[model samples]
Structures are given as structure tokens and as C-alpha cells.
Target: MKKTVKLTVNGTTYERDVEPRTLLVHFLRDELGLTGTHIGCDTSQCGACTVSVNGQSLKSCTAFAVQLQGAEVMTIEGLAKEGELHPIQQGFWEMHGLQCGYCTPGMIMQSVQLLDRNPNPTEEEIRRGIEGNLCRCTGYQNIVKSIQWAAQHKNQGQTEIPEASAPKVDPQPIAPVP
Candidate 1:
């Protein structure tokens, strides 16, 4: 059955009829044409399709579009305003947090929520914060550094963003669990 859903996304209101089985990720990508939210693992194991629904970061692939009635959704495309990148996005760019760029959008979204809950997270905390998101390219060292850079500059409005640099060598890749 086709169900009508009304939701706000990126400060824009959208009301459309979607399939009951439609996932939010599909709704955003197919209906609304917001393709920045990538679909990695449809089973929600990967955080590539993460989005902010009512200020909480979640895997969009697991969430039905009908379930988001009257909800506010924020995708990666909404993060920047007036041509200025969100600190997290800027951090990703400056820190070289992404390569191949498949996972950048979801990583940034999750990082935003992570910083919201804990603005000053340690390296371990940052790692744990983004444990759900997977990046196949550019090991997580740069991602961690990117989040750290964002944390350092959070709430500092209009200030010049400093260059992000990690002095230490990149760590060895972690072996996958069997």
C-alpha cells in the first residue's frame, strides 16, 4: 500500500506518498533526490546511510519512511549553510578524513551527533563514537583526527579555522574478526 508521509528535511517540508516498505534512505534518495546518503549495508551494519531524525543519528536504511511521519530529518546535504561548512565537514576536508568518499556523508552525520553528546571526546571515545560507521578507504586515523579537530573548534563562531595536523604516524590496520 502507498502511504502518505509528511516530514521536514534540511529545513524543507516535504509531503509525499511512499510505499509502506520504503526505507528512509530510499525515500531521501529516490523520492526527494537527496543522494548524499549512501546505502552501504542495507542491514544497518554499516552507518553509511545514517541521518539525523529528530536530532538523533540513526541508520536510515533500517527506518521506514512511514515511521518518520511528522519528523525532522537532516541529511549530509543540510550540514552546511550559506556556503560555510559545518565544523565537522570542515574537519573532514582539512584532516583528509575521507578517500573514495563513499562513507563521508554518514561519518560526518554520526560525528555531529557524537560531538553534540560529548564535545570533548578522547581518541578512544571518538573511536567508540564512530564505531558504527565504516570507512574502507583512508583508515580511521584521519577520521579520528577530523573529529578531534571539530571538537577543538566547537562553539567558536566566526573564528578562523586552524589547519588540522596529526603529528603521529598512522596506525596499522585492524584485522577483521572471523
Candidate 2:
């Protein structure tokens, strides 16, 4: 049976019918079309599906949509405002915090909570804060720089960074060798 779940996401209220077993990650991606939250490991180890629930960082895969009937959820899409990137997001962009970009959304969301609790976290503290999130690329050095950038620039408003244009490549058939 599909149960109706009403919740606020990214400052918008939405009510949808969902199966009892539907994970919040699936609900966000499949139902709501919020695909920024990636699914790495469903076993709750990757932390790729992290989201903010009621002001706390949560792994969306660990909870059912129905369990959070009236919760306030914030996904990566909510990090920007008025067409400007949030401090953490700006940090990631400027500091090259991501390589594959699969783990970025969760990392940013988790960092939100970390900075909330400790605005000026030490390098070790930042490392401990994001221990739950795993990144296969970048060796975590740049990710740490990203978070540190946010910590330093949290109070300043950042303009949106324009997306870099990708170089166009045209494939040409190889000449036959005689």
C-alpha cells in the first residue's frame, strides 16, 4: 500500500504517495526528481546519500520516507540561494574538492553540520567531521581545503562561479593503412 508522506524539502512543502519500504534517497531521486543526492552504498557506509533532516545530517538510505512524515529535509539542491552558491559549495568549486563529483553532495551536506557545530574546526577536526563520508578521488586533501575555505568565508557572500565550457572533440575516422 502506498502511504502519503508530507514533508518540506528545500523550503518547499511536498506531499506524495510512497511505498512503506521506499528509502528517502529513492523517494528524493525517483519520486521528487532530486538526483543530486547520490546512492553509493545502500549499507549506510558510503554516506553518499546524506541529507539534512530537521537540522541534522542524516543518511537518507537509512530511513524510510514514511518515517519522516513531517520532517524538514534539505538536499544539495538547497545549498544555493538567489543563484549564488553556498559557502561550502563555493569552497568546493574554488578549492577543487571533487574529482568524480559523486561524493560531493553528501560531503557538502555533512560539512554543513560540521561547520554549524564548529565554525572554526581544526584540520584534524575537519578530518574527523567528514570521516563518515568516503571519497575515492582527490585523496581528501582538496576536500579538506574546500571545507576550510568555507570556514574562512562563511560570512561572506559568494557570487556564482560560471560553469567552465568543455572543449569540443570531434571523432574522425582513421585513414586506411595500405
Candidate 3:
């Protein structure tokens, strides 16, 4: 039997009839046209398909669409507001954190969750928080730097915002490690 589900994604509401076995990631990407959420692995091992359901970071691949009833889903697309990029997205861009860009969306989504929980995350905290999202680009140096930059920018709000929808790096700021 098909079920009707209502998903509030990226500040938009979508209602659809789907099977019980439909994966949330597939529903988001294929059904809702929210392609920003990518699925790296179906085993829930990689955090590439991560999303925030009601403000908690989770692996979308392992979740069923039916389970998310009445849940407010926040994907990477919903991170920014009024053309402003999320600080996390800016962190990756300015730090040159991405290479192939496969894991970026998930990283940004997870970063939002991290920031929502702790706006200012330390290097170790950031690393531990994003341990699930794997990136084989830039050797993760830029990724760490990106997160650090976003933390400082979000806290201060002094950083120039090029893309309001997704923050870009500020010339790749290299902070001094104390």
C-alpha cells in the first residue's frame, strides 16, 4: 500500500505518496527534486547522505520516508537565507576544502547541525563531529580550516558574504594555530 507523506524541506512543504520501503534520501533527491542531498553509500557508513531532521544530523539512507512524517527536514539547500551562504559552506570554499565536491553538501549539512548545537567548535570537536562525512580531497587540511573559518565568521559576522545562499571563503583565511 502507498502512503502519503508530508515533508517540510528547505522551508518548503512537499506531499507525496510513496512506498514504505522508500529511502528518505531517494525521496528527497528523486521525488522532491532536492538534488543537493547526495547519497555516497547506502549502508549508512558514509555520512554523505546526511540531513537534519528536526535539527538532528542523521544518515538519510538508513531512514525511511514514512518515518519522517511531520518532520522538518533541513538539507544543504536550506542552510542559507536570502542569498546568504551558510558559514559552513563559506568555510569549505574559502579554505579550499573541496576537491571533487562529492561530499560537500553532506559536510555543509552536518556543519549546520554542529553549529546549531555548538556555534563555535574547536578543531578536535569539528573533526569528531564531521567524522562520518568522508572527503578524499585536499587531505582534509582545507576542510578543517574551512570549518574553523566558518566558526569564526558565524560568531563575528564580519566576513564578507559573496553568496548569501552558501557562504564562500574569504580569500581562504589561514588562522594562526595557538
Candidate 4:
């Protein structure tokens, strides 16, 4: 039987009919075209399919689409704003956190959730938080650095800003240069 379900994903809402047995990962990747979440291991041991559901890190592959009728889901695609990259993504890039890039999206999603719970996680906490996420490349040294960078970066947000932001082009078109 097909079940009608609503999904609030990445600040957007969508309602559709789906099979009760449809996994959340399938719904996200296939239905919504969110291919950022991957299915590395079908057994759910790998965290490659990780996503934030109602602010909690979960294995998307193991979750049923119908189970998330009213939950707010955050995926890798939701982290960045407009054209700017999220701090975690910046950290990953600056710190060289990825090697193969196959596990990056999941790693980033997990890191965001981890930092949310413990904004100042220690090295051990960082390790434990990402234990479920296995990366065949980089050996996790750079990944830890990336998370640490994000933790500190988030902590810095607590302070007040002087001008709010740097100067940038406005949404409206600029006068054509002569």
C-alpha cells in the first residue's frame, strides 16, 4: 500500500505518496534527488548514509520514509547557505579532510550533528563521535582536524560582530561600467 507522507527537508517541505517500506535514504536520494547521502554498506555498519533527523544523527538507509512524517531532516545539501559554504565544509577543504571524497558528505553531516551537541568536543570526543563513520582514506587525522576547526569556528560565533559582514555585491544589478 502507498502511504502519503510529508517531508520537511533542508528548510523546504514536500508531500508525496510513498511505500511504507521505502527507506529514508531512498526517499532522499531517489525521490528528492539528494545523492549526497550514500549507501556504502547495506548492513548499516558504515555511516556513509548518515543524516540529521530532528537534530539527531541517524542512518538514513535504515530509516523508513513513512517514519519521518513530520520530522525536520537536515542533509549535506542543507548545510551551506546561498553560495557560501558551511564552516565545516570550509574546514574540510582547508584542512584537507578528504581523500577519496566518497565518505565526505556523511562525514560532514555527522560532524555538524556532533558539534551541535558538544560544540567543544575534545580529541577523544571527536574520535568517538566519528567512530561509526569509516573513511578508507586520510586515516582520520585530517578529519579530526576539520572537526576541531569547526568547533572553534562555531565557538567564535558567540562574540558580537562589529559590522556584521564584509562588503559584497548586492542582489540588485549594479550600474554598468563605462
Pick the TM-score winner.
1
- What do the candidate models score in CA lDDT, each in turn? 0.89, 0.89, 0.84, 0.85
TM-score of each: 0.89, 0.87, 0.87, 0.87
- Give candidate 4 misplaced runs (Cα > 4 Å): 158-178
Question: Per-residue lDDT for 1-178 in model 2, tens only?
Answer: 9999999999999999999999999999999999999999889998999999999999999999999999999999999988888989888877788999999999999999999999999988999999999999878877887898888778444454445511222255433322
Clashing pairs in 1: none
Ten contiguous residues minimizing lDDT sum, candidate 3: 161-170
How many clashes would you count in candidate 3? 10
- Residue 101 CA error for candidate 4 (Å)? 0.8
Cα-based RMSD of candidate 4: 11.2
Tens-digit lDDT string for candidate 4 (27-126): 9999999999998988888899999999999999888999999999999999987766787887787677899898899999999988988999988899
Better of 2 and 3 by lDDT: 2
lDDT of 1 by residue, 1-178 (tens): 7999999999999999988999999999999999999999788888999999999999999989999999999999999988888989888877788889999999999999999999889888999999999999877878888898788877666346654443344476644432
Angstrom error at residue 138, model 3: 2.5
Scored by Cα lDDT, where does model 1 land?
A: 0.89
RMSD of each: 3.4, 9.5, 4.2, 11.2
